[model samples]
Target: MEPPVPSKPQFSLPVDSDHKATQFRLFSLSPPHMLAFHLAWLSLFSNFFSTFSIPPLLSLIRSDLHLSSSDIGRAGIASFAGSIFSRLAMGPACDLFGPRVASATLSLLTSPVVLSVSLIQSPLSFILVRFLIGFSLANFVANQFWMSSMFSSNVVGLANGFAAGWANVGSGVTQLVMPLIYSLLTNSFQIPTSTAWRAAFVVPAVFQAVTAILVLIYGQDLPDGNYSKKSKRSSSTGSGKNFFTVLFTGLKNYRGWILGLTYGYCFGVELTMDNIVAGYFYDRFGVNLESAGALAASFGLANVASRPGGGVVSDKMGRRFGMRGRLWGLWVVQTVAGLLCVLLGRVETLWGSVVVMCCFSVFVQAASGLTFGVVPFVSKRSLGVISGMTGSGGTVGAVVTQLLLFSGSNQFSTQTSISLMGLMMIVCTLTLGLIYFPKWGGMFCGPSVEPISEEEEEDYFLLE
Candidate 1:
């Protein structure tokens, strides 16, 4: 007549004495964990590459498309808006269809939209294409869900962080590569500045399309079987609940909503920075296009170390402090980020701003890593939907921050004000560090933790 012990999740990898996978090694995960990590990061990268494909080249795009400053801001808004909607839908889609199917579909579906940026000749058309291209950004939901299933909650933080961190480098990679492509096309190939920007879209589209095919052909939803094959119920009945009910369950989770806010501060800021930094440097400091992009790429590139570092910190801390450790990581990084944004606003020099911006990227992207450290725990049932709820916060944050601080005719002043917003929101979300969100509950301060279940995975839906 005793209450049953809650089960723990297992996601360990096979290893040999030498540390190379007994079979093959790629993207850092071992057998049963391999394809998931590989496909997740690669597909996530494709989406990011396509999503931010326009930003680094905004100067060229603005001139070529005859877009005014306001038009450029609106284009960023449109793109963010599209991502918000898609994140909302993709969360549920991933829950129902599995990450593999949903992700592959996302890449293939958005590839043409990404490629079609080549055809835009007017401001309205450019904005429309950018909006459609934002759908690619929703792949993060699938990427997280996929990693969650592939690894145990013990290491889920590291897995999620590493996957996202590396994937997010796409933004930085875009900044570096786009400028080079532009230079090559214009200088080497003798293509017109106007025409060369259009051709640049082809590279990302090709990458997106190829990754989609790879994921569909070879990716597995869970190690045991594919989502459709492993799951007993119809995909329509994800988490064994009615679709609307599952969604409502996610909607009602107040913690998930709060986590979404946290994501907004870290990732929302990252997205906004990705779009505006190039312009911020150009307008405020009078840097040339290539120079500005190179500067912005520093922010993007920091994800290579900062994000995964945050995840590793959480995992190590969780070992000592339990769930409180994870919350501690988020709180500390975000609080630092809030402070950094304020510093960034006050600094006047370009190099000073760049230094502050790079520092800010580290904490914000780390906070993003920490936020997802809590995501797969939101529901043992609907990780996809819950991830959607939280993930949607990033895009929402970007849009709101963009509108409130950066979206006006006076760009310079607006950019300064937006940092204040980041500071304010970080303050609001800080109390969540006091919360213990797991179903088994957690400690508020010290090193208390939760036990893992090796039994059946409970009917949690895989987003592939």
Candidate 2:
């Protein structure tokens, strides 16, 4: 007797005309849409927290481990280097295993590395631990992919922006939280500085592990349901191509490469700043540890509104001018952000530097959000791969900037190198002109009369 034919996957959850969520209710926990949004961002937040938790205590760690300036820079580069390949791999993993599994597995695997910060007795060990801990950042690809899967084009920018922006708050939160934890241990509890810094890492480790478990148990992979519940046939068709197919599809698309390069400056710059901002304030302005952490927090805290604003503006532009509007908006915002970064490097006074950094933070983060606002439209069939490529670009950009500009051997002063980095960002933003969608048109051109393919139709219906 022949076996029973597998029933087709059914999507019973409420969604828009495109089988995506129309509204983004902030407080709702409804499965597969809002619920997925919260899980994605929270998981990313934990990862970000774990990734940057050491920066706030870098000074103490440096003293404790007897690290040199070059060693510090190498550690920073190592952290970003760890993320680059993992992010590239995570895209394909999400395509094959689903974001729920991909995200949770990454967090769980990396949490132990985060906890290992206390074990570093040498520069090599410190760098190695940071490298391993950086793997948690691959969850960022999963976060963006999940949002793209769950939300519709009309609000995809907003959903992506909010999820990323909120998750980014972890960087800022770690800035403040790590310092406070260290202070409490050293001051209130009378612990030694060396012991306090090591102990501070335990909090982020626990946070990362708990969030990973939560995601694995409760998170949904698609609007329909978790990927595991679907039959073999439905899983492949529903989630798009398999790993290598999706990877190659995203690789072959010129648009994904251009966006990757563009994101490197925006989000990449943000990562660099997260690594150095506290130390910059501490050394340059003679601020105390807590004060420097507070100031550094300001730059990261801007993500709460600045990134979402970029997405909101992108959505508004897409409504008015399709992909062209989104591209134009990205160019303009990133250009302005570059200008602000140049200005930040020039500011001489402490308060002046703070003000300029705040403005620079806004434009840089918004540029990141805007960059992603255009990502979901690049190739729907390979969204995870495209997202991974873009996410990895951010880390690559950070590594390059850190190596050339901020690394210990560079002759350029920290401020001067920052100005040069800004100059590079301005030049990079020009590449936005190279991105063009067949149906929605290019930045300077109008849409062609050619018919929209099924993938284009689903991802760009808002242009109609």
Candidate 3:
């Protein structure tokens, strides 16, 4: 017998026609929906933790390895550069192999690279390890794709934001935890400083491996079931699009490219900040390593609320005003974030800088949440591909920003470089003005009077 329609949930949570959950239930572990949520975020969390585990210990690593400033900048660029390639490939992989298998495979493959950090001897080894480990971030494409698969359009923003936002906290958590681990090894265990720093990596490496295993065992590709059991006729996530079709269709879509560029500034800037903020505090303010790491942690920890807040607001705006509202909301919040970033760079006093940084974290991370809020709607047929493109754009942006603005050989001061990044953010945000939809309109214009195309019709069925 067909299952009865799910009752309207009490707390604004409801089930969609596809049986996907509409409201988040944080503590639930029910299979398919909630279980997938936990595994997806947790796995990504470990990836983020491992990816950023080194930054807090940079001083120790720098001293031990004798890394120069130019070497440091290049290493930072290498991490993002590695992510760019993996994230681009991850989209089609999700479309073909399903997010569960694709995400699990990538995490497992890269977890060893995380472990290899303990073996680094020179700047080249450090850079190469960082680049290889960056591939773990490809799971981000799967995380979002999985959430989009399991949640209805009305709440996909919230799902994507919460998963990614919570996962992103790993960056902050690593900033705080890595120093403690290093300190424990050196001060308590009496391990030598050089050995202690290397030993510190074992924790995140283990954490990454374990989480990948959990995801592989427990996670689901869609609300219905595992992708392997899905019939070929199923319209669920990761089923219909072929690899080349998904890749080319997503690439051909102008809207996806625009989102990619905009996301580059918002999420990309967030990544660059994660890479440098601890060192920025240590160098500029003369704070000790532990204190620098703690301060930097605030920037990443803001994702706990700020990024999810952006998603909630985007869903609300989309509900009320449709795609036009989502676009306007994204543009406005991102612009404000850019302005705050500029202010953050200009603040001189440490306390003042901390305050500004906190505020900047709110808007920038929220802008990331907002970017994904719009991503699922761009092309349902090419959802994973578009996601990969935007995700890769973020890493590309970080790499470019790091190279041009904050590089060791650059003439600009760190403060000046930060301000320049904010300015670039503002310029990139204006591009949102160009995004429009035939059914829901755009930031400044009404829907087109021209007849709806087949693509528009498909979107209407999903969105309406």
Candidate 4:
């Protein structure tokens, strides 16, 4: 007996008679779904803390290490390089191994490197530590895989939006709290500012380590039999290669490249905004590091609102209308916002610059929400690969933008810098629109899928 062919697994929505009542009670009381949601959100928070903590600390790192602007730029490049490589490798890995194992492993690995950031004294050492941190930052890719798997396709956009939006809150938190934490430690304990910044790294590192443990203890493994079962049928019926073969072939599709470019542009803009805005504030307004951080934090907070709002709108409008429409809208908004920043370079009045930045952040984050919302609808089986490819595009975009920003022997003035970035966003937006427009009108109606239950919805949201 060929190992007693495993009984075909029964399929049904994982709901019980008490599910509605339980879901209602959970939402009304303390739902199990809510617990899962919080855990999912916390995973993103841990990931975000690791990723965004460096931006506010950049100035302190530069000053203490006696490093040049180029050195600061290189640190970011190292991190993005790590992310790029991680996506290329881990995207398929998630498909093979499942999200739970990959996410937990990556999160656990990141903790030590995060703790080690404080120990580095030399520029090369710092870059090395950052590269290590970046390599572990593969958690984000794993998290996206988890999200796509847990939630149904209809609500995947909203789920992804909420998770990503909340994750951005980590950036906001770093901006608001890091400066205050640094100031208090420096004054009361007489800790050197560099060491205080190290504490910021240490705290998040500990949190991530703890999160890894919790995930291992409490997180459920995503179902993997779906792909395996499908692949077996395909092979026996002479339909196609195994899962890996299909995954690789998916890459050859033109649609993948178009999606990748779109992701790249959005990622480039987001990284530019998150990583460089503080420097822009400092340069343009002469705000102290603390105030500049607070301003950046404010942008992150604004994203919390705008991001989810964008997702809700996308769901209501349908994918093509929702996804493409938001892309065009974001392009226009961001272009105008970027132009305004260029025009108002180095605002003499601090408040004026703050207002402009607040407005700019709304558009920036809206674009982010819209871009990620469309990832799952492309294909359920290929979500991990597609997400990985798109994510890689975003990383490339960031690398290119960073290169452009820091390029040339001549130092760029604040006005010229802002204007150039603005121009780039415009070109990128146009390119994305031209490539996506015809496809956009057709995507929403192309297929129909099951709707996710509230419990599934919560699970999906957290996965991202």
Top candidate (lDDT): 3
Instruction: State the lDDT of candidate 4 residue by residue for 1-464, as single tens digits.
Output: 55776664332334333221111111221223333344555776777777777788788888888877777778777776777878766677777665556767888888898888878898898777776777655665666666566555555556566666776687688777767777888898899876788876777788878887876666653433334465567678987434675477447545556656655655556666677778778877788998888888887777677765655555555544544555555455545655654544545577786787677677666666666666665545566777777777777777776767743233786556656766666566555444342333333232133556767645443332
| Per-residue alpha-carbon lDDT of candidate 2 for residues 260-360, written as tens digits (9 for 90 to 100) | 89999999999999998899989999999999999999989999999989999999999998889999999999999999999888888899999999999
Query: Better model by lDDT, 1 or 2?
Result: 2
* All models, RMSD in angstroms: 5.8, 3.3, 3.6, 6.5
Please give the lDDT score at residue 243 for candidate 3: 66
Per-model TM-score on C-alpha atoms:
0.88, 0.94, 0.94, 0.80
lDDT string for model 1 (349-444, tens) is: 888888888888898888888888878777756678889878889999888877767775654584567568667656856767556644334436
In model 1, where do residues sit more than 4 Å from their true spots? 1-31, 232-241, 410-415, 438-464
> Which pairs clash inside model 2?
none
Alpha-carbon shift of residue 117 in model 4 (angstroms): 1.0
Report lDDT (Cα) of residue 111, candidate 1. Answer: 96
Residue 264 displacement in candidate 4 (angstroms): 2.5
Ranked by TM-score, the better of candidates 1 and 2 is: 2
